[model samples]
Target: MTDAVQQKEANTRVAWIAGVGASAGLGAALARRFARGGLSVAVTGRSRERLDAIVAEIERAGGQALALPGDVTIESELAAIARQLVERGTLEVAIFNAAGATRAPTLDLSAGQFEAAWRVTTLGGFLFARAALPPLLATGRGSLLFTGATASLRGRPPFAAFAAAKAGLRSLAQSLAREFGPRNIHVAHVIVDGGIDGERLRTSAPQRVAERGPDGLLDPDDIADAYWYLHQQGRSAWSHEIDLRPFNESF
Candidate 1:
């Protein structure tokens, strides 16, 4: 039988996550969670080394995963990755977990820096959706998930660029939901409203991590669980957006 035919017969489902960074980060966590759920996972990022590390860990844990390293901001690259995913199996979920930001005073923020943030966060999301949605529509079932932040809700000083980018991504998710939900495609925007207890923060700001204390930051695993839950939701009660934060979080 043809591979496509075999794929249909086997009903193999795949999940594709973009913007994977360190193994201890949310993108890697999401990959591991989905793979453990019996779905083959494809992870993409600019850092091939990091993506490979995440794939290795997932495979070590007896979960199927592969690395597809590329720039999320590049449409051609995303299209190629989408083709690769189609060859592997039926893509049931596509998550845009990529992020970019420039923390500076509004007056000091360069226009180029502002555009860069939008390119990575918002435009990257748009390109990924265009590439991923075709295959998803072919199956007539799938989920397109975007990762947002507290910045998605409001703009804070020194984070105006970040906030604008995230907010645009959130709106894109909403528009996608309205356009595709009726076609049985689930689109969700997850607003991560607080600090994440990930490698980046722990390494960059140890003092901040300590200040947060126990369970003060959002756990990547817990966030992954929520994404899994969203995918498993029945169409009767679809959720378009959800915010996540630690118990001690002010917002």
Candidate 2:
């Protein structure tokens, strides 16, 4: 390939991951994965400090990274994220990892809490996809991935709000995949079952570390591997949705 052509190829390799969450678990791992692959990465979240920290880690490892801290719940903020990427280059991969879960009995849950859950998971997923898709479609070929939870399929117990939100997101993914697949834009959703072994989950439920035992909790890095795999799938055999869990996690 000619030098100019090769340089253009490198410039077009960009990935955007949103909803870094408090500890930046899956989002940070994904940023590292793509950055290490030599792609220009832009990460977004409500926490500026956490985003910067992730950006620093990637940069320290000799990878390019940009931190654009913003809330996934806001439409304008998400639009700005998309605008920034379009101004700089193109969106090759857009991953929505922002999620929130609220545990409360239907009778005890406050209206605010229920609304907040839907805002972050369902509405937020819609806004992110709306902003990310145009740019992704501009690339002629790219991936739009959403991180889902087991709640996506089942609504049980104290997770009514979370389950409803996730189910909505899954539905959104399905609709988008069918609409954009023919245009070469691959949209997929991943249902992450079980507890993710990370700073947030480990610290929150220390006692469960032993309760579940070996291979009980899901690995963030391992889940990240699946995200990368989905992004790399060939157009001839694209996967619309995938479920991930630890080996010992029950169905």
Candidate 3:
């Protein structure tokens, strides 16, 4: 049988998450949720150790997962991620969760730093969509979800690079949705407006956590649910974009 045929016959409950590490973060939470729901998740990121750790967690939960370490900004590596997923089974959901966050004032930002943000945030999304489209289109119905932040909608001072990159990603999602919605594919962008309640952030930005107050941070599991909801939305009345934030967050 052809590889494609074999893959089709293999477990087709495949979901691809890019740019998230395996532990105590959005990626880990998302991988677990999909795994529990019976989808084999393929997770990619820059850290092999973290990805492996995540895979172990899923395996322990009786959910199949694959850990592939890669840089989202690299085209060849990104393409490999898609190929690996296709080898496993049908690519039912492809999530562009990678982003670059080099916060700095415009006056102090170096050219290289600015470009790096775009490379991962904007160009990375483009390449991921490009790589995932064929497999997704083959299924005739799949979800392409991009995770966005408040920066996606506003260019705040001291976050020019990050904001610009996020804005570009949002724009790309809109364009793809318009062009491909009629083709039976769902493309949605989610705006995550507040700080995420994750171990990584708590350790790194304790002050921000303290400032946000009790229940002020966004939950990763909650965010993952939103993505799954987008994936399962009725194609007839699909949502192109949704903004999620803590109730206490300011607009």
lDDT of 3 by residue, 1-251 (tens): 88777856475778999977747788788888888878999998898889999999899989999998888888898888888887788888889999988988899999999999999999999999998998999888889999999999998889999999999999999999999888988999999998999887899899999999987999899999888889889987899999999979999
Residue-level lDDT tens digits of model 2 in 170-199: 999999999999999989999999988777
What do the candidate models score in CA lDDT, each in turn?
Answer: 0.94, 0.88, 0.89
Top candidate on lDDT is 1
The backbone clash count of each candidate, in order, is 0, 0, 0
Pairs of residues clashing in candidate 3: none
Query: What is the lDDT, from 0 to 100, of the residue 27 in candidate 1?
Result: 96
Higher-lDDT candidate among 2 and 3?
3
TM-score of each: 0.96, 0.94, 0.95
Best by TM-score: 1
Q: List the residue pairs that clash in candidate 1.
A: none
TM-score ranking from best candidate downward: 1, 3, 2
